[model samples]
Target chain A: MNTNSDYPKRICSTTGFPICRSAEFFVKANAVLGVVFLLIGGIAAILIALTRWQAVHLLPVDWFYRILTLHGINMLIFWILFFEVAILYFVSTTLLKVRLASRLTAWISLVMMFVGAVMVDVTILLGKADVMLSSYLPLLAHPAFYLGIILVAVGTLIAVGNYFATLYIAKKEKTYEGSVPLVVFGATAAAIIAVVTLLHGAVVMVPTFLYSLHLCPQPDPQWYRLLWWGLGHMSQQVNVCAMVAVWYLLAAITTGAKPLNEAVCRSAFVLYILFINLASAHHLLVDPGVSAGWKIWNTSYAMYLAVLASMMHGFTVPASVEVAMRGKGYVRGLFGWLTNAPWRNPGFSAFFLSLLIFGFIGGITGVTLGTQQINIIAHNTLRIPGHFHATVVGGTTLAFMGLTYYVVPLLWRREYILKPLCRLQPYLFGIGILIMSFGMSFAGSMGVSRRSWDIDAGGSIYGPTAHLFLALVGIGGTVAFIALFLYVGLTVGTLLFGRRIAAGKSMEDWGTPKVLSTSPGHDHVAPAPGFAGGATVAEAHPTQGTMVLAVIFLLSFAVYYFANWKALADVWPVR
Target chain B: MNQESSSGLECPKPGWFQAPSGNERTWIGMAVIWCLILSVMMPYWHFRGKQNSTGEAYRVKPADFVKRVEAFVKVNTGEESLVEDGIAPVVPAPPGEVYLLAKQFFWFPVLKLRSGETYRLHISSADVQHGFSLLPMNMNFQIVPGYDHVLTIKPQAPGTYHIVCNEFCGIGHQQMVGKIIVE
Candidate 1:
């Protein structure tokens, strides 16, 4: 393939990562949009949290709902998708060592997505679209609201097409030999799920868009919910896939950790593509007109396959890190690898934090809550948000944030502006999210309603503990908000005015290592500067610490799972 | 860990479909067992577990269901609630199935039931989708229009449990609250 001669290309001296002008444009464009949405959402989060806080009760009812709508749409939908779109461009171009395919199409999609996101935000801010993120039908919003979502989804679909085309181009041009990199494979899964999810968006939103115009009859609420979750819940699965992909990418990039087994990891990604979206049916388990067999089938056995995929990831990621650590001969005890793991590196720390919270909080809670009978107590409570916030905000968002640390210095050619603050950011954010999610989950278990602007409703009862937990949510949310502001401020400051790198290439010190081509030898540390971060022990074994962590995770899962059942049994004692 | 760092990258390819290592197989086996156990729990609970959410279903028009609930409430408007305002008085309904109409902002009437009586409670939404969440007890189900969900439940303890609409219906959705008083 001939270079267009118009597009600039360069390889980074520090990381050896390729930078294509066209791909960089897409990355910067989408990433900036993601940040913009984050800012809007973060502000809205504070207001909503304050309102939900019983003592303060900041925003009025309508404003509370309106702000909550903006918060959900901006953070969950717009911000994450925009960032993932950016990731797709990066994967197809820089990772594959190929120029981005179809620059014009990418630009068009970017513009359309931006316009749609703006349109949705404007509709919500104007107080005409407070139907919450679901915007359940018969509760009409402005026609523009539906149109905005449709445009965003359609735009994302187009971008996904461009991603596939780029992959095809990579293959045709013989960018690399045999299978693509693990990062690329995982990204491929995410893109595949994204296309399917966007289609579901079209399936529901098109009719609702038309209904808003009085051009079509309203679909049955049950039917709408069935289809709509294919969009709503499945879209988050895209994030899950992306987050996992990024996890692998970060592990390799930061720690030089080889995936413990490429085949198993790839199989896990394949499983996500095949069965993850079906987990959406768990949302409808309590719904009437849906059969028991359907609910049980979807939630119980089939969805477990997806859960298996998540479990595989939960194992392989940390195990891979352990392999890397043990390769450097850190095997002193069961936790030697963990002890030697990079704590100061924000890139590593954030990813590690994400993995922990996502599994313990999100994964265990998700499986427990998704259970057919167990959903009766958990569904439509704050636990729903609690579960997803762990997955999305704590897991995926943290990963993305971590990835950005490398992107700024390596891709943007600017050193991170506030390194000390950057190191502390993830811990602060992770702690805040921890408190918020647990507080919400415990409160929800106490029967606090979700999506209700007020918990202290007329005729509905709540215990004293519920108010305390709500207060915790408010405080945690405030802390998270401040952390988010710091992140955005630092990120923006870095891009604009951070020190420009002057070819400060090192003596094979800390930079991008070569992509591993063989199964790792646990005893031999690679002769790389960052690879041997003070190897402390003699006898080398991989993932000993990880195995212990896995055991702990399993025990926690068992305790939480049976505890829910115990709670259920307490309601109706079986003799 | 790969050797080349800081410059000139080599796009290396490893054994793509390598067999699972020892730890990998062990974890996979554990996962399989855990998954099967969870699945078994579902069937076991559905068969013998008393907290099974799956129950009877019936179809009813919103017009008729609302009328039945209104009549039931009219007859049983004897014991006023001390805890909350605007609540219609509660009294025990006779055996068999009873009606609960879910509309814009409330359930039609407070259901008063005996603690051990297994009454088939028929619930339906009058307008859109609502949720009948029995709080404190932590029992919930979707109330959909045109589909009456008949739940055969025996309230375990004699107490007042709030029935709140957990699903988002509309602007006044936050206010939709009812009560289930078990005597």
Candidate 2:
């Protein structure tokens, strides 16, 4: 062990990952804050879902938009970003075996972020900022709302700055080798996206704040929408990058999985940093004043690279797991690897569920809905929320929740409370999200409004079909809400009162995460077979199982894409 | 204490950036094909699809468009009616470049169009931005002020179609409904 802990730290016994005092404090603080926001946002999500369900229109028109704004900020921005910051710190410091770049700046950023979040929520709850998540132009909110957003953006920028600096320091100190590990590279992609996204927030919000203060002219709505989505939709892409990174990380941590090829994984990350945020223009597909060429280039040509990157991940992640399982003596048939996966572990289950939902539901629907002509149908409808719920909620949120289980024991040095409930958490949540996503998408296809409080629109009559599917939305929301409730409760309980882990349990028995290489079959001899009692995995496993799964995924994607096109064609006869 | 061997079974030497395996190349090739397919699908849909744009827009102030809409309502051959929600009075228009306005809470100058006859529908917002969402049909677009969105539509089979503002314009956004009576 590199017992060079003059900087107030100790090497973790179980995982061999370092536990720097400053890094641990920041990680715990941000993580706790992340959970706090998740609880609030998850509650708000249930309320919003219920309200959208016509049979039980839970909130009034005003409260619906209000809670929605809070939900959007809290879940998408606060919860995800805070947790990602922690992840960044962990990947930079512990994984690379280096100290955080600067502890003071990280603390300040956290405080600023917390204060900003509180301020934004306060404004929303006071009903002074019910402009929905988009908060479109000419419809002004309190200045604090924009300022709050700006502060969070600035704080996040500072954190990203720290991440880069930490990397530089790690390189200077000669920590690890050969391109900084796949997970760190993924986090780096996310951080790069964050820089671009946050700058947009600053550009738009600063002027908006000034406008609210009567220090500037009323900003153009079209211009605001353009700049705003650079932050709005792109921020979610940042989450996508981080979320996929977490998938790789958790798979490694839990199942001893590594990418089938590290170079491929790194290349995918590169593609993401280059082209993922281009898909943000899908938000502008329906808006006038923006040229078709711009929208087409963005939504079609450039954005496809990001989708391709995700596709690479979709294959490699599970392939990693399958290869890992096969190496561990599950090398029977094609699916023996899959059958032997650690479904009982919350960490493993969450990663798997995240992959499935993201690929099957989120990825397919996103590409279809993101198409230029197709956006006309899905853009402002409940379909928009439906698609995102599957991606950000089902994919990113679940991945984070799954990761929390490992984080608790690993960083907090605490064993999980309610072990049985922890195991059930991912499956139950996954099921809930599936139902919720279906209901929302179905209701959306029927033309249920996205931000509307009343599907009936003062008894305008969208027919019982709308009501029926919306009721499905209701039932699904209820299921998902219950599952979310359990998650929040279990997580909070585990954090506050979980038992301490045994000594000498750094990451030894923690699923033996072999994330360093992804060589195929089982030529792996651990470099020196008997050095650390490491077993040599000796059977050559065929990777055809993952290939089959990939084909199935592609078929599902094609079917959904064609179905939307058919729907679009049916809307009007050819000119 | 944990050993360094666990991070990787076959740990790459300190600068291993490339994967010699062929699986990665196959994956990359597949990704490139997908990109090309997605790229081509859009223009194909744009030209070959029924959902193609009318290539229509002309800048106009919100006030000027409202006046133009009002003038269209005056000269058009259609009965004056209220949209389904009975919220806003809609003056149905004839089959020219029909002017329409979307504001905080409602859409104006709803159209009464002939079945299977293409009508140029010009929609703009008086304030902020609103959505011109035709339900059941599920055709929708944004209504940005100072910019006109001209959609050419031929409603098949005569029926009353409700237009809901799907965008978040304001608190009364849900109540912003307009109707098109296809005759």
TM-score of each: 0.93, 0.93
What candidate 1 gets wrong by more than 4 Å, as runs, is A1-7, A301-303, A503-540, A572-575, B1-14, B71-94
The TM-score obtained for chain B by all candidates, in the order given, is 0.81, 0.81
Tens-place lDDT digits, model 2, residues A329-443: 6655778778767788888888899999988999898889888888877878888778888999889989998888888788777777778888898898888888888888888
Segments of candidate 2 deviating more than 4 angstroms: A1-5, A301-303, A502-540, A573-575, B1-15, B19-24, B77-95
DockQ of each: 0.42, 0.43
Give all candidates' CA lDDT scores: 0.80, 0.79
lDDT of model number 1: 0.80
Kindly list the per-residue Cα lDDT of model 1 for residues B1-183, writing each as its tens digit: 344221102233433355676676788889988988888888788888887666356677778878877776677666554435566555646556677888898877766778777777778878878888887877778788878888777777898778888888877777888877777
Docking class of 1: acceptable
Q: Against the true structure, whose lDDT is highest?
A: 1
